[model samples]
Target: MNLKFYTFAKNIVKIVLSPAFRVKTIGKENFPKDGGVLICANHIENLDPPIVGITCPRDIHFMAKEEIFHLPVLKDILPRVNAFPVKRGMSDREALRTGLSLLKEGKVLGLFPEGTRSKSGELGEGLAGAGFFALRTEAKIVPCAIIGPYKLFRPLKVIYGNPIDFTEYRAKKISADEATKIIMDEIRALLSAGK
Candidate 1:
């Protein structure tokens, strides 16, 4: 359950499972090594988080939905792997607190800015949660996208985009909804660029 050991285990899972799914990645260098970086990625597969986490050089804590947290074995393992539950459609305050706390601790936090996986493989509008967290915490926002409605043996590519500083937006007192839209637009651009 230790952070290091959990990371090691997750890496092993990625190695063994990824090849079966043919997951590939590009733009890995965009991931920041230190500090509170908010990695806002589009969800493609259940494998998305582990793929990003294992590929990223830093240990990242992800915000998972509450349902996953209640699962017996997953509950035990996910927290160890640095994932905490966010009650969907409910109070996002807990998620914000946990995310900001991790950033304050100089760690990376992973989130799905789109909120849910796109069953159509098309990008969705950004959720205000991701932007609010980044703006309030002053964490750098790293736009990310995963291409491919990944299937067994199908090729997948996870793209990490450049960091977006929210300082100017913060200075302007931009609304979280507006900030999220901007952040997601950046992510959409990166996703398109990769293709």
Candidate 2:
């Protein structure tokens, strides 16, 4: 990843966003100091990824939709900032492999378990991809909630909950769906608290 570019982009984003929103972050202390971690967040808007990315203390490699990667300028910039494409509405095995590889290498992987943005601004049902990665690597899962009306000068909050451990589930070999539910439940709780 382009560390210098990532830092520069993050700073620019912070400056651009600071004037329009009262961005607040909570539970940053919950992030793991080392090792791979899966960050599962509820998707609400297009800016969600960068919002979480900047607020997060660790550098997050996010799995963005493949379509976005096709955009003109973003196509070139996204990859440099640790963003990768994942085909949606199908079983994109290559994306899965990339995510798993990052985790196994002790890198942070950010995913929107809902798969797509929530049009109603509410948390949606989570997909199994996140759970599968968590189970396979037994990586700590951090449930995040991004709450916003996104109005001018309005308050926008990103809350990170305590990390979830799947050691027991991995031992019992739980289904991916079940594991996803657990992760989603934590996200729901965070959203509830954020409001």
Q: Estimate each model's TM-score.
A: 0.94, 0.97
Worst 10 residues of 1 by lDDT: 1-10
Candidate 2: tens digits of C-alpha lDDT, residues 97-139: 9999999999999999999999999888999998899899957
Give the runs in model 2 whose Cα sits over 4 Å from its true position. none
Best by TM-score: 2
Report the lDDT tens digits of candidate 1 across residue range 60-150: 8889999988888998888788888898877678778888899888889999987788888888887889878877886888888888856
Q: Candidate 1: which pairs clash?
A: none
User: CA shift at 104, candidate 2, in angstroms?
Assistant: 0.7
Residue 114 miss distance in model 2 (angstroms)? 0.6
| Pairs with backbone N, CA or C atoms under 3 Å apart (clashes), candidate 2 | none
Q: Where does candidate 1 stray beyond 4 Å?
A: none
